[model samples]
Target: MTGPRWIAAAWGQSSLRIWAMAGRKVLTEGASDQGVSRLGPRDFEPALLTLANDMLPLDEVTRVLICGQAGARKGWVEVPHAMVPCAPHAAPPVPAPSRDPRISVGILPGLGQTDPPDVMRGEETRIAGFLLDRASFDGVLCMPGLHGKWVRLRHGIVQGFRTMMTGEIYGLIARQSVLRPMMDDSWDEAAFRHAVDESTRHPETIVSSIFGIRASALLNTPAPGLARARLSGLMVGCDIGAMRTWWHNRPVAVLGTERVSTLYASALAAQGADVQALAGDRLTLAGLIAAHERTGHLEPSAAAHG
Candidate 1:
């Protein structure tokens, strides 16, 4: 209670993000590439110590809170999951005993669905944060990332959710597949819209249309940005079309830290769905902070400052 009061961290497969908290207020935040996926089991201690060096408490105990893939089977520790239909704020944090006596870490458990066998890790924290802020948010949340998630929240509990590997597919094709050389980091709203419309109406044509990307660049030589947007639109369109049952005509919100969420917003909006965009990191931090407070780890004095 004398030094930095809380440490909140989100561990991903390829990235590790941290926040130093003075009670409920964040003092500083940082990120690194030393995610669990890239390190050995024994590397977590050194990795966390290095990343959190500046925020380490001096001669005082600091409560640490964590969420995301870091609690997965392959992460810092495999925390037990809380079943769905439970409040994000009510879900308990799994105590992750640490070797560092100055720090006690608690990882918020991710939500699980058993009907069709599905699970999520980090995104659940953001969901809790969003719901914490909105208080009354209901309907569907579309979180776009390496794996796109469509989650349903009724009242305050998560009813169910589904995942789509749209971004993964896009990355594979753009970075390693035949489309690699045909595009660059650029934007073409018109071309993207066209592809979205075409795909939304007839996703079955996706196989044939995918070939057109290579052909267009080879024959007509359209702008690289145009071809890139076309490809993105196609994949995003396919994802939305397939998940129409979950989001179609429903109140859909897009949450993410990148432009992909915006693309999803545009696609969902264009297709007659109510769309709202929520900033990513703030929600993630909010969720972590909420968990700390709920678990009686968040300091009341710090909460006021935040």
Candidate 2:
């Protein structure tokens, strides 16, 4: 156990998470709020060290594997998108060198679609991890977050994908609009499904129903979670409707947290689609570790030297 450990980290818009791995087994982990959005010039290195320095040895050279917005144009370095119709790890990751020679960092590239114009960063790494062991998996991947992604994976290769702003739209209506007051903090399954079915069947009625939320709240005060569920379902239903080709009666593997993935599973199942959800943390780490192993960022022999 006395050896140099490899670093696996993920930086998002709001948070940074890292795991110290000693040959695939995590030795320690840490998290910080120093995500890309909160960082500026000369801040990336410090931010990473803030979470990693203590876990690393002073004499050994550490290898770091990172993904997410840290590789964005405004992040640590702008990594070119790995054009789709390529293996998950087809293109070598972008090299990210640093003034500090104590460690070396490699940022995995995101994927992009040309004709329809779409791009994704961190999620691509997560998908690569999911497919690391499932080389034969050929189906749709539903990644739900602030901006959900619908991706196509064929024979372990990332074919293409699209993004949806359903979460953003939900935030706007649930937190900023007049419809906000009617939304409940808790979930109502019945109400949620009702909205999904109705909205998917008749997206045009969403506007009128949106107004009804406020009216119901102000006058009738019909139910506690009625508005909240309906709003969520309506938004998701619309998203699914727009991307019917991706999920219509097709099996999908959802990657996200319990709430989001479960909701997607429920929505797709209602449409007679087979759905499976793989939560975020586990898979993201898997992807990062896979990248390090495949790229030889952390070789077994190197650990003995450390």
Candidate 3:
């Protein structure tokens, strides 16, 4: 491989992030709104080139290792999912058809489950990155996002996992449901904690509890901040309640430094679980670089030199 021979990309639904790399060190970085959701099959290469063309050399092909939705069924190239009870990077990178000879694109495969018919894209790469340094990690990984994932790992292999739609549900309730008028981004910590405690204790009443938010606004006109926090709490609490088997008394490392991650960490801490929050983006990049190295393209000596 030539110098600056690799590009690491994390392509999601709404945005695309890429890093030009000389081995493990990032040489330059770029991003755009041209996510997989907004482009057709033929548009992927061009969208990537628009951001990465300058990083390419004239004679050699620069390998682009991508994770996330770019490997979805409708993405740049539909990569298959690696079944669970396997290493996060169990499936090797699949080559995507590319036009420019200067660049070669390969996407990492996502993880899937059979019994429950569950599937995850992009997140598996993050899991791989998290386990890169923690080889003996024998616990659950709590990743909070629009589609939160609770992953169980033992002996460095993913045993099984579950997905929760807490964030998505919260978004719908806050923006599209009757509770919209009473919601805002401002958060009230006490209200959030109270809601979490209530919902975790009686998750079956969530439907009615949600309605109570609207009713409370109608009668008492609670601050929008409080209402929003309460709504988030209800959704996250329900998830925590259902995932007790995975998290109870376990060492859980929550991914992301975002507000959602904080909420999960707080809720898990309250439940008396050992918890720690990790930086999401850093791990994501590490996973991409790890995949790149595992593919046998970037040599260890080359990385050391860079």
All predictions: root-mean-square deviation over Cα?
3.1, 2.3, 2.7
- Give model 2's TM-score versus the native structure: 0.93
Write out the backbone clash pairs for model 2.
none
Rank by lDDT (best first): 3, 2, 1
C-alpha TM-scores of all predictions: 0.92, 0.93, 0.94
Error (Å) of candidate 1 at residue 60 is: 1.7
User: Per-residue lDDT tens digits of candidate 1, residues 112-227?
Assistant: 88886788888898988889867777789999888878899888888888888888988888888888888788889999999999998888888788879999878985785887
Q: Give candidate 1 misplaced runs (Cα > 4 Å).
A: 1-4, 297-306
The ten-residue window of minimal lDDT in model 2 covers: 297-306
User: What are the Cα lDDT values of the candidates?
Assistant: 0.82, 0.82, 0.87
Q: What TM-score does model 1 achieve against the real structure?
A: 0.92
Task: Order candidates by TM-score, high to low.
Answer: 3, 2, 1
Query: What tens-digit string does per-residue lDDT give for candidate 3 at 1-306?
Result: 444468899999889999999777888999999988799999999999999989988777677889999999889989999998899999888889988878777899999999788888888989989999998999999998888899999877999999888878888878899888777778899998999988887888899999998888779858748988898888888988888888887799999757778899999888788999898889999999888877844433234334
Task: In candidate 3, list every pair of residues with a backbone clash.
Answer: none
Candidate 2 Cα RMSD (Å): 2.3
User: What TM-score, to 2 decimals, does candidate 3 have?
Assistant: 0.94
Best by lDDT: 3
